[model samples]
Target chain A: MKPFDRLTTSACALPLASIDTDQLIPARFMKRSRADGYGQFLLHDMRFDETGAPRPDFPLNADAAKRAEVLVTRRNFGAGSSREAAVYALVDFGFRCVIAPSFGDIFASNAVNNGLLPAKVSEADAEEILGLIETTGAAVTVDLHDCLIRFGNRNYSFTIDPIWQTKLLNGWDDLDLTLSLSGDIGRFEQRDQAERPWARLPDRPD
Target chain B: MTATRQPQTLFDKVWDAHVVTRREDGAELLFIDRHLVHEGSFHAFNKLKEKRAKVRRPDLTIGVADHYVPTRTRALSEVAPDIAGMIRQLDDNCRANAIRMFGFDDPRQGIVHVIGPEQGLTLPGLTMVCGDSHTSTHGAFGALAFGIGASEVAHVLLTQTLWQKRPKRMRITVDGATAPGITAKDIALSIIARIGADGAQGHAIEYAGSAIRALTMEGRLTLCNLSIESGARCGMIAPDETTFAYVRGRPLAPAGDVLDGAIAAWRELTSDADAAFDRAVLLDGKDIAPTVTWGISPEDALPIGASVPDPAAMDDASRASHVREALDYMGLAPGQALDTIRIDRVFIGSCTNSRIEDLRAAASVLAGRTARVPGLVSPGSHLVKQQAEQEGLDRIFIAAGLDWVGPGCSMCVGMNGDLVPSGERCASTTNRNFKGRQGPGARTHLMSPAMVAAAAIAGHLTDVRPLLRSAS
Candidate 1:
């Protein structure tokens, strides 16, 4: 996973709310190997019509938005499904950060693990940022260290779990971070085994 | 001097018991009691291989091949090679890791969430994790269960633990009695409709109230399964006699004195009298009606008596536009009566509503009635299929003209061969009605199993109550 601290790049606005993971990368596209990039499949249905023609009206189809690394959208972005491929699609599509009023709990967790920042701002601030991006096709800056998002002259603070913030700032995968406390985990397991024997499973015969 | 303990919610009790360690940043290291994996875990297995990490506790980790397994037949040879590969990958990965897999050939094989509780892997006061979002279905057993991403799946496979910050607790209490024919699915859809999909965001919801207590274990599972749709981290119902009875004789559950002791402990898994919650919501069960989703999102639901909502009537511009977009994709016109809308086909199977009770409900509705449109009724698990067959439910479905196929997550997700065709609308007993969820360009109307059966008979979205009344 790439360590992400700050990124200043072109941003696109998808003003829609409840943009679910299915829309991010549909279930059918998930069957492919992750080694094959998912960038082309990101919002595939929304970006194209039934006959496979690109929808020119979609903001991401614009030449400037095509190169965008930041996405500004409404509340409840990445709302459905626990598919991590959604985050992979965003990262593979060159999005380094997603700014929204709120995100699905699993999606936000998946985002940070893949070095993609899920920045949460106030609903009004999200709307403002999305509008600015739509009107100006602006380049926005996301500073993880300070937890701030800068669009043009206006600056808005964003919220992320401090632990996630630490992970992204260091680009540490969860396993590495978790494995650091192996000793404590072992001790806890022993104590738990004694206290709650019912929770522990007996070994099955090989 | 010792201070008196503050009253705790059911979520706190379960979560606190599983906490192995706490970081200064407020994230707790949770010890997962059960780790359920499906075919989707292949990515995590690949990551594990890259890191040269073996599964920490293979005994606690269970695998089921469902997502990509064909429901038409048990033969993998008949399936599309790419789809068949997914099941084989899970089989090989589980074999390599020494994990117990209920593979496609296993009679117990089914949707992960459905089989977890059926096999007694899901228990009260335990912490369970899975790659699928509907893992919350196990919370009906009073467990702290939630879905994780593939990266988190790898982390759990490596360490048998997960890092997490505690989510706030919300209590949704439903009192009063639901009228006959109003099912748990109706209650769940009503809750999501009132809460607006993201209403329970950032919180773990504990469902309480007389109505909740009255629901059977299957009903509770169906209710909790849809919690993720409300943006909740997880949803749980305090374990009671219903939960204990359901878990009592299951194959994987504790037996004899151990079972007795386990039930005694589970009895204590409820919220205390004065427990405080971060948020509280109250809904009258009597107000709930047979509900269905007319638009893409689950929250775009209304009672059978209502009409499709007009986007122009919505006060919020963003919400209005979303409604407009959903209407366009669904091929629905605003102000159109929901029950009058016609459907091309029907599906009655998914992790959300394919248990035996759900099957029985659909069968009761379809008995002695021929379906006007074609449909399919796949049970939640192979065991459920066998049980339904024993009870003659399969015969009823077959007689009604709906295909009685093998068990898997069929039609609910089109990952397998079963798919609703493009431009054709389907009344389905699945969780999400998202665009292309069932298949590309397939319009799905989400409802209860019995409701789906009713629609299958009527060839349109109609109230199931009248048909259910006639059945009785």
Candidate 2:
């Protein structure tokens, strides 16, 4: 994971709400591991037709959206499925961050893990940003340090969990963070193991 | 007794109990009591291998081959190459990690969510995690269960602790008595319809009131299984006598005094009378009909008798356009009668509605009846199948001209070979109705098992109430 501070790039406005993970990266494409970059399979059902030709009218397939690094969408973006492949698809497709009124809790967590910022602004602010992006094909700037997005002449602030902000900015490994809390975790395990003998983990040879 | 209310919700009680430590960023390191694994967990295993890390608590974790395994009882080699590899990978990874795996041929093999509760692996007052979204289904046992991503899976594998931001608490009270044919799936769908997809976002919902309390364990599972569809991280029902009895004799459950102690502890897991909720909602359970999704969105659902919603009727321009797009993609016309819509296929399985009870509900309808269209009946687990067989549910299904397949997530996710062909319409018991969820250009009408069984026999989206009433 790479540290992300700020980025100014063209924004792709997908106004539809509840763009679920299944639509983001369908289950068919989940067969392969992450090595087989999911860029092509991103929104496969929506992006292309049965003939393998791209849906020309779809936002991502549009001429102007080709270079979009920031995805601005409506509420509840990535609303279904816990497939991290959804995040992989977005990142693999060169998106630095996704701006939405809200995001699926799991999808937002996966986004931060992959160094992809899921900036959440108000619904009205999101619509305004989408409108600005539509009126002017200008780039949208997202500053993680300030939690603010600038598009056209307007600037909109977003809220993210402070911890997620640190992770996105510093590219912190969640595993490492857990490892750092090993002392407390160990103690909890010791007490838990003693208290709930039935809940004790079964023995396994290392 | 004039006392200040020190109210705490069920989520707070369970979450606070499991907190290992709080991080600087306000995220807490919560201990995971039980971790369920499936074929989708292979990527996390690979990452663990890459990092050369040992699973910290292999005993707490259990793996099963479900997502990619065929529900047709076919040999592994005969399955799709990619899918076979995933199943094989799950077995190999579990073996390497010294974790117990319920493979395809194992009698205990089933959907991760199904097997967990049936085997008593999903206990009350436990903080459970799985790599699949439907892990929320285990919350029916009063466990603080939620799904985690592959990377989080690796983290949990390496350390039995997960860092999570505390979610807001919500209570969804379904009031009134449910109608005869109104299954848990209908109540869940009706709730999502009332509240848009994001209605529960960032909240851990506690389902309560008379209607929810009346549901069977299987029905509770069915309701919680669709929590993710409503954008809730997890949905839970506090453990009661019903929940206690269900967990009492399961194979993995505690016995005797240990069980007594567990029950006593679980009894305290309910929300306090004066508990403050971030959000509280109410819905009439009796009002829920044999609902079905007519559009790409699960929230775009209506009663079986209602016509497809016209985009022109939508007040919001953006929302109206979305309706138009879903109608176009679904090849459905506005104002079209939902029951008149023909379905090419019917699927009656998935974590949402594949339990023994679900099968029995469908079987009761399909008995002495024949399916007008191709229909597949995949049980949730081997136990469910065995129980169904013992009760002649399989005979009923076969007699009704439906295929009684093996246990696994079959057409629900379509990672396996089962899928509705392109440009085909299907009445599915699955939770998701997203575009192409069952297959490319496939239109899925999410419904309850009874409704699916009714549609399968009718060859269209029929109102199941009349059929159910007639059968009784």
**Best DockQ among the predictions, by candidate number:** 1
**lDDT digits (tens) for residues B88-112 of candidate 2:** 8888888888897788878889999
Residue B240 deviation, candidate 1, in Å? 0.8
Best by TM-score: 1
Which portions of model 2 miss their true places by more than 4 Å? Answer: A62-64, A201-206, B1-5
Cα lDDT for residue B78, candidate 2: 79
Which candidate ranks first by lDDT, i.e. highest? 1
A19-100 in candidate 2: lDDT tens per residue? Answer: 8999999888887888878898888878888888998888999877778899999888988899999999999998889999
- Tens digit of per-residue lDDT, candidate 1, span B74-192: 78898889999999999999999999889999888988989998988889999999998999999999999999999999999999999999998999999999999989999999999
True contacts kept of each: 0.69, 0.75
Regions of candidate 1 where Cα sits further than 4 Å from its true position: B1-3
